[model samples]
Target: HMSFVAHSGTSAVGTKVDVHRSPTACNIPVVARRNHQSCSIVPALRYCIRNERSPKAPSARPAQDVTTSLAENLRALGADPQVILDHPDLRAADAELLTSSLSALSDWVPRRSLGALLERHPPLLTAPLGAWADFLASFGFQRLAIQELFLNSPDVITSSSVYRAGQVFLFLRQLGLRNEEIVGPIFRWRALLVEEADYQSAASFLASEGGVPDELLPRVASTYPGLLAAPVEGELRPRLQFLKGLGPEASRLLRGFLWEDWCGWIHGLANWSTAVAPKLVALEDLLPGGRPAAEALLREVPEALKCPPESRLVPNLRLLTGRMGIQGESLFVLLCGAPAILSLPPEQLESRWVFLLEAANGSKADLLAYPPYLLASLSKVTGPRFFYITLRGLTSRFMNRAFNGGDAVASESGRRGREVGAGFGIAGSNEYNLDLRWLCEGSDDEWLKRMALEQRAGPGGGGWSAAPLALVVGMAGEARTASHGQEGAKELAGQQQPQWQEAGLVKEELLLLRGDYDEVLSEWDSLLGWCCDKAFTERGCKRFEEQLSLFYLLIQGRM
Candidate 1:
């Protein structure tokens, strides 16, 4: 039912190794092997030599005998038989020239890695050694340094296209790294030496758009070598324009967007602009600070460009506005303070909203003053540990009623609120008080310690409640009452009088209130198990146990 196989390939040291495949059942899909003969220099040479000696006469001799004859002929040419055996290409090569070439290169490359160098760059055998040595010397590399560079990157000495290599060297010099400075970067990424028009285009664009001076271009290229490969029109220009539109601050941030593959960059940028940008612009009105504040949002958090707007940003906003009933300028104020809330996946945002609205019975205004609540992982930190302090009865003294008209009004309100609290608004000594900024950004240990301190301080505002249980009952009644026009909200509001004690409900009922738990749970379980099982069996190695362990951890969280 199962079998193991070995595949052969030449390794880094020029040694042949067999890589084994895992055992699997007959039902498993099998890759078709290609039918092709491998080229052998020894056999080909023997055929040529025998045919030349006797055109029509038949000559029957064993393959070993032919190999012995070939070895004897190469030995007569004053070449090392072992070197020829190691570098098989030398069998058909100019044997006399190969001997001189190896001796010339003996001082530069080590005896052990010489075979590796020749194997990687066999063209070096035919190419003039004098030209390569002269090229290295012309570049001002000392004999010792040349040996080191060749050892590190053998391609510097053995490149077939010396003209192309020279073009790359000239390009880097133009970038501003002169003499010895170019050696480090060139040796690290040999691809930088390959002359391409795109490298010039990218450098020109950065100088023009980024205001990078001509002499300073090398600094940027050395810091981010990938820019040398970016497509001028498709990738470099579009990303620059996108960042520039944000404002001066955001435009300045563009310099930090390190160079990566131009193709991937364009694909991601196009996806973000077409899908994510519209949602960000749409949410601008939701920010309490309005236009100026919205511009600042992009400047502060450029990573929002990578998130899927429809899947992540939209769903998170919906949970706050649609489900939690936090509407208008209040939502804007909340998001402006902590933009990272938008980065959380929609489902994670939904779970946190469920905790805040239902379990805590938190007011919409409280969320505005403290937005970090949105970023908290509900099932992990908020639900199990921090739930008691934020329960229904707690009065949110930290909540600030600042949004009167717009920016000026909110600014004045914040100033007055800070004065009233005596520098104790969010991060105040109050048991429930937490600086949204600190709580959201801090490590897990810090968050846990803060939560533990809050627990020790005793309940501050109010007592516990199970009001989250009422969301299901409220949804059903509200759907029916929607037939009425303006009265629909009034009907829904009047029906929301039931508290945790007033309405008896169980934990299981509350969880299944909004969605079909059975279908969601089953689908998630099947998908995870299938993926993990496939990875584990296909790898068939003890090294993959960590991946299997991580799958178990995720599976536990879902359940």
Candidate 2:
């Protein structure tokens, strides 16, 4: 017994049919009915056809050989012939040509899965096999490459326009994609070959309108294959204009990053336009520099485009100006320095600011100078270092009236404190901005060395050899060991000279001189070619001495 679904529309009465058949007999028995009736036949016609079968008196009989020869040829080719025979949609496939094409491919292509491949992409069997084979071979594609191409994108076989494929392939290669690089994009976006002009126009628009250079075209195409089909006037042009409307900084940054290729750029733009933009425009009144300053802030931190204005950016701005006591041009300076602060959660930014103010003896100016301090992890670098500094008596706490009350009160206190000359010089001065700068800026070895030097001098500026140098060294070693186990501690400890070892001021002096040297070089370079016209009297002498000092430092290292 065999069971088959028979849905036929041939019946004038309009009906459905359930057809059951026996293997041996051809029994054609019709049970007739009125309008919209359904019935099943015995073994004669196992399958029903739209035009031939009477579905109102729907009956089943023996199934016919719709693709007997097609099945036989497929089975002979070592492929699943049953798939083609079983499918109702593929019932009319030309058996002779399909079989001939399969037989012809026996030499170069593997025979095993050809029928299954055709079943998946029936158009390939009907498409001119010779054209596809010739097209692949023309492009230096080997048998393996051809097989891979077909397996990766079966529809490419039906896209018989070799000229179209060649055009896109050449265009991609021109855009810096090699033969291997072209394969993945080609397979993923087969329409590149099928609709060549559309893709070419899109690529051209990216170069002409979107400002994507020739070099980045291949990357852009691969990252945003859908862009090839995106409408120029509607989607691409509007998005380009919207991004350009943000400002030169935003436009330039977006062009550099190719935001069109990024999936989230649209959503980010939406957020910026509706939420962030209004907040920034509104900031012209609230903050110092107004909308222009806000634009500059967005340029510094493009990620700010994705954040909500009221909930995220506005709150962080308030915290900086209100809680941190940063106002006017200082607020602008801080924003320009660390625009990422706008994205930080209120609690996290507040905690960091609190720690900075309390532990590091840092002021608003210090935070402005080093914006990255706001982004540093508390537990990893800030918290651990703060605890260590405080424990070693390197830092002293003073009730900052400005922070306790407001900026006005803090200003009054600072005026009185400066008048008294209360905390002056290296050891006595509680303002550890220089120390904090070095601590945060220097590497791990440098950090350990800097801490040891500060601790060695004690509370007085001239107290050299006051504190136990061995104790400082031990503390650094303990911190290193605690942070990075025995191996790291041993490596670091080995770098330091023994407590009894003779002091060396040469290296320290040289480092200070080098830092100054960099500043001078920066000033000179800032002039560009204009420096040539300047008088070379003292300039030559100053540079000569600078070189001489650097050479002396090199010699000391060798010694």
Candidate 3:
């Protein structure tokens, strides 16, 4: 029971800790109390990364007399003092290495932060951390980063080796990943950096023995980092073999998910047999095509099974069947057409459904016809473009294209068969089968340009004509007239030629042809931009055309 306190006084040593005595010393290594306060290690010390910068070097032996002094230091910083004192590794730790590790760790974080972390994981003290810091530094991490790395993954530190970390780093580098790309995944999944499994060997085996393509090697290493920890002989190989037995497509699909969505969860599965096969069964049970269809769906788009069938797939099917009246083979068709839709939030699916119902004028046929609509950004892309065309009474362009067997066959219904008459142009021809995908495929500006181009190429006529722009202006005049009687028509009398440059509408006047809109480009120029503006949309009482008509009248001479 030989217990002692470092002779604490201003003159005694490295840190001037006050001294006194009490019985609350750590259970294993008796800790002494000073002035009725439990002796905690010195709190603030110069924080630095090892070899980043060092304090005046001292003997590896702690400046304090008792080994308990080191314990006090750890306890003060927030480590569970008794855990360190009780650890067998501490007893075996070489004096030189342990001292060096502690000093490096000390410079790594603020006093209290380091203490809080060590309390959660005391065995971190048992590992040779100095070498770990050195390897991490080789990756160009700063002191703050090294500290966070330690705090984030004490489990890795407890069992990891510098050599193991290097092997993992080398694997990624060999895959052509830059150091930055390697650091991001390793930082996010710290265990990947230190686990002793031959991840490089596993990757090589996957590329050679398992048939994974070499070009995909970099992304596989960078994205599904934890896969590196899967044991080459027992775990990785066996699970991979089982997955291969299911079929090559099956293996490729789930393995792709190990990087995309549900990444961490999939890698943690015991084996595809115990964890994934059950989901496959459930997916088949829920889908109309059964197992083959479900497998085929995943083959076409590997991301479909990223979420469990019961959680994501079943609900999406219910939305289609219960909400949208999609029955039998149609449900499978929708999933296959756009496999990613299954993973969308139920609310998002509902929104696109609701939006589509309105855009197609209460029709859900397009719901099954193009499942990608379900994956579109309801607020940003689909909503803006659909409303842009619809508000102008131009949705007729995409409303009805008869199916030629399976492909779209253009029909005349889009024109309402209403001849251009005096205001709207393109009197007669017949190609109104507008594929909705064209609206969402491009950026906002691109979408606008596509709309402009389509309008320039007459709606039914299918050749260049400026009639649609004049039709848009005429349509605006019509909405206003419908709402405001003869007064709306009176507003059109005051219109003047608009300065196209000031309105931000870029196009040569030649694009207009002979039309009513040739006189006022500003009104429709701001019109498309206005459609995307929430503030503008909310403020106007009428459709965009009506508002543009009103704007044209109100701003008569300004443009």
Global CA lDDT computed for model 1: 0.46
Worst 10 residues of 3 by lDDT: 22-31
Cα lDDT listed for each candidate: 0.46, 0.50, 0.51
Each prediction's TM-score versus the true structure: 0.36, 0.35, 0.36
lDDT: worst 10-residue window of model 1: 44-53
Ranking by lDDT: 3, 2, 1
Model 2 alpha-carbon drift over 4 Å, by segment: 1-66, 72-80, 85-89, 104-108, 112-116, 135-145, 159-191, 210-374, 377-381, 388-559
Per-residue alpha-carbon lDDT of candidate 1 for residues 285-380, written as tens digits (9 for 90 to 100): 565444445545554466565566777777777776777676554554455555677777665666455435433444454455456667665544
> Roughly what TM-score does model 2 have, to 2 decimal places?
0.35
**Any runs in candidate 1 off by more than 4 Å, and if so which?**
1-92, 118-130, 143-145, 148-160, 168-189, 195-199, 218-230, 238-300, 303-373, 376-559
Tens-digit lDDT string for candidate 3 (127-208): 6566566556545545666777787877876766554454455456667776566553237446565555666676787677
Q: What is the Cα root-mean-square deviation between model 3 and the actual structure?
A: 19.8
Clashing pairs in 1: 286-332, 287-332, 288-332, 393-462, 394-462
